[model samples]
Target: MNWDDMRFLLAVAQAGSLKAAARSLGVDKTTVSRRLRALEAALGRQVVEVRGQGLNLTDFGRRLHRHAEVMRDEMQAVDALAGADTGGALGTVRLTAVPMVINQILVPALDDLRATAPGLRLELIAEARDLSLLRGEADIALRLARPTEGGQSVLARKLGDLDYAAYAVHGAAGEMPWIGYETRMSYLPQAAAIARSAAAEGATDISVNDAETLYRLVCAGHGKTLLPRIVGAAEPRLVELPYRHGALPKRELWLMLRRELRELERVRLVAQWIERTLAVRTSQAQPTRPPDHRDNGADP
Candidate 1:
């Protein structure tokens, strides 16, 4: 039997009378009666009997009502799933970033993100290695370098530069040893710059792959190491070295995402939050140069 007719049958069976069923279905009693008769004719069976004050369902009608109930439940389940899939600002957004940035920048600003987007959940992947946005590994990514190869599907935007400086423990003096990245990370621009400076001064003493470990080593008076200005500035014991020691190349931070996700309301909100938060933090950490300063015919 047609599902529409079955629906009318179920409604009439539950409501007991055509008038009540019509009230529930928002239709007139005569329309309900006509539809119920059509359902009975389609099944070729007398499914209802006219009782003194209401309609009573026959055994076949009761059986059909049970099947219709099951179909209604299944349809409701499908609609619920569809609604969840289309929900705009409610769901998990996976974000990936380097460990240092996650620890120094994203972690401190998470409360702001949660306050602004209470319906959005965050799944953070903190690692130095880049995760694949094209493979659906992450929804948003914060990287030190702009991606060179994700094709048109990838959207990359420069947020700001991560400035670095040599940090030494408070009250340390004399020719200090230097800490740097291990051989595995020597290809990093910061590492290469530190290595050259250390070699010229004969100051290399230790190497480590992780930025936190390097920071800790420097704090213990092991040696000075290049650290992100934001991290170094927060530590009371660490003092920034003068620029004359040679400047390390500042790494540009880029926000990367899949092009399709750029328009998703939740993702877009998170992206804007990250951009604003990092911009504020970076400005606070770096020293502002005078507008009048010019270097080699270029603005400094």
Candidate 2:
């Protein structure tokens, strides 16, 4: 008689018992009995019978069950069609970021972005290698460290400070392992601080460059590295190093895009998604000092 009656009849005809039907419909047995009685009363048909063994579906009940199945399929089709017109934006937006942020921050917040833009697609480049926006590398770049010199200028937004604190794998800080940078780079601000700290603390040096590799080296219980507290805290094994004297220097991370495409839809979506997703991490990275994350928190 109605959509609900059809659904109840369908459940009952398939389950064959009031108790079983009630469980399938997620309602009480009494409710199922009441609805069934009402359906039969309104239709003037013997839809069910109580036997010595249990309940049985009458001929009319079987007929209703077949139609109910068709009805369910029709309802599903209607729902799908109605939902087709809903959603905000669409299209693939390519984005690039350092590995630490990708692992610790961005990866976790993607589901929320999906909810915001159901048809939105994201392509993430997680390597440390600088991808060129002018050369078609990425629609948006999440800058943890300074951009590699000589790419192309773009519209940049300072996400926030990437707060750095001297950290080690638990007790490894006592034995300072200064993570150094790649060869051919000049003295960076953080490396300079670390060198001064090592000198001040009278500790030996352990050099490393790549941020991802440095994190791995620290995780293996090797030594301490000046890393973004927000990113490093995500790894369960690593612990903040005991500060020798003062607070470690902090570096502000920037979100950059192609200078020409600053207003493009794809770039805008990607940038908005990145800022919204990493806002908390950026906020956590308060500017306590100077820019030191030249290579995403790796020593200089």
Candidate 3:
């Protein structure tokens, strides 16, 4: 009997109906019906019985399904072996990004990545510090700042812009405290912006080291804090506070990697995955100004 026809039987048996099987297989109901008929004709026995809205498998059908399950597993094994031999995504890639981006963005989309690149592994470093790609500390990195130190060996591409905005919990009462960052982080433009706003608002003395903390504090209604629009927009409980004038601070989202390892299959796979993930959010929220393309860290 044809294995392709057996595939249809497998789907029908698992799904319990021709319509459900067709939906699972991405084919029309008639196609599933036709395939099942062909399989029955080849085997010269009734395999499936349609009763009302459900389908029941005959004795032979159960036997056939067992064989089909074995075939499915064998096929998957062969495909995996072939993929590994032919440079499929395999091995580990160390990726680093800030806590908010790691928690709110990358972590959520990992299942999708795993489905596509089952052999690939990820080492996610969630920190505000920029890890050294040159020192082999990481295979790939998603940074809010453009790399100015890795020389020609490091390749940097602007993924998109991360727009910032002040946010407070929905319907939060008058003069919500301004949650600022820790003193050492004051050099960051985002921190400076918050300091200016807090000073003008007569300040509340709350401070934190990271953006994720700022996000959680704002969600808890402790106060308003500067947050990436991408993060703030996703929380329905938090609303973007109106700006007095102009735009909030914008950070450039840059993807950085060692030029030498850029072509490695696993590194390339993770890099593209990171780019695709950020693209969806960045595209939805347009930056006030286009990303700065001047310092791409390309070899001169």
Candidate 4:
């Protein structure tokens, strides 16, 4: 009924608890709860179903949220039209990406749109979990997994096949630390390639999960990690441990958006930026040279 109530509704859905939402909103939990109750009562509808862990938005809440987003965008656009610069989109963009891409790729490419679309506000959430886009958890999701199909909503794009190569610290490629992604998430093609290549080169096995962390650890001489060749190339001495003699596993990366927000300008800008950044990197790549010295495969 009110933007305050709708904002509270989004907070509850996203934060998972009134307390959490209050913390995010920088207000008292009781106030958030009271407002939510009042809104539900005003609407004469059960907006949320309470759960042990958090509140789940009811069907009514879900429908209302979609409309709220449309209204939010329209209002934001109107406000921008009234006061915004001659050319640019303005508003917050929520993006969720896994660690490696966030660190190695996303961070560097953030300034790409600054000259063209300076009004875009980016709120990036880096996590490993598959977040819910339907609930407005994020505007765009860069995921490795194939997207869902045939349901309330659906859309897809085959971005490109991302390649992963095993790498270690300088002079340590032949004697790799042989790390794996955290614990349970290991045995993925990336990790498997690392294991296979390391075993081939007579190296030791060390396990880890997050690609960014694993890459950092490996850079610190803790172990070797399977990293995308392009990302790993950012640092020195992280040689490619390609599958077999010389092949990288083709791990496809896809850009997915809620079927609804696909056309939204903010989401589109971020997505296009990501794609453009990757394209630039791909095009500007130079052939890598072998290490200049003998292979001891140990930290200096």
Looking at model 4, the pairs that clash are 181-208, 181-209, 182-208, 182-209
**Which residue pairs overlap in candidate 1's backbone?**
none
lDDT per residue for candidate 3 within 164-205, as digits (tens), equals: 977787766246868888889998888988888787775566
Model 1 TM-score (2 dp)? 0.64
Q: Which tens-of-lDDT digit does each residue in 1-300 have in candidate 1?
A: 667887678677767999888876779999988888888888899888888998989888888777776665455435334434444546668899988788777888888899888788788899877776654568789988868745555789888788887777866623467788988898888888788777876565578898867878888888877888877877778777654445667888899987766656678888988988887786777753322222334322
How well does candidate 4 match the true structure in TM-score terms? 0.64
Runs with alpha carbons beyond 4 Å of true place in candidate 2: 1-89, 144-153, 199-206, 245-247, 259-266, 283-300
Q: What are the lDDT figures for the candidates, one per model?
A: 0.75, 0.66, 0.76, 0.69
List model 4 lDDT by residue over 69-100, tens digit each.
66655554454345333465567677888988
Clashing pairs counted in every model: 0, 3, 0, 4
Candidates, ranked, lDDT: 3, 1, 4, 2
Candidate 4 yields a Cα-based lDDT of: 0.69
Per-residue lDDT of 278 in model 4: 81
Q: How much lDDT does candidate 3 score?
A: 0.76
Overall local distance difference test of candidate 1: 0.75
Least well predicted 10-residue stretch by lDDT in candidate 3: 291-300
Model 2, 1-300: lDDT tens digits are 556777677667656788988887779999998888888988899888987757888888878767666666556435334433335545566788878777768888888777766676778889776665543467688775666522334566687776677766754445555654554332555666666665565543456656677677777776666777777766677666556556567776888775655644555666777778667665655434332333355442
User: Model 1, residue 186: displacement in angstroms?
Assistant: 2.2
Give the C-alpha miss distance for residue 205 in model 4, angstroms: 5.9
lDDT of 2 at 233: 64
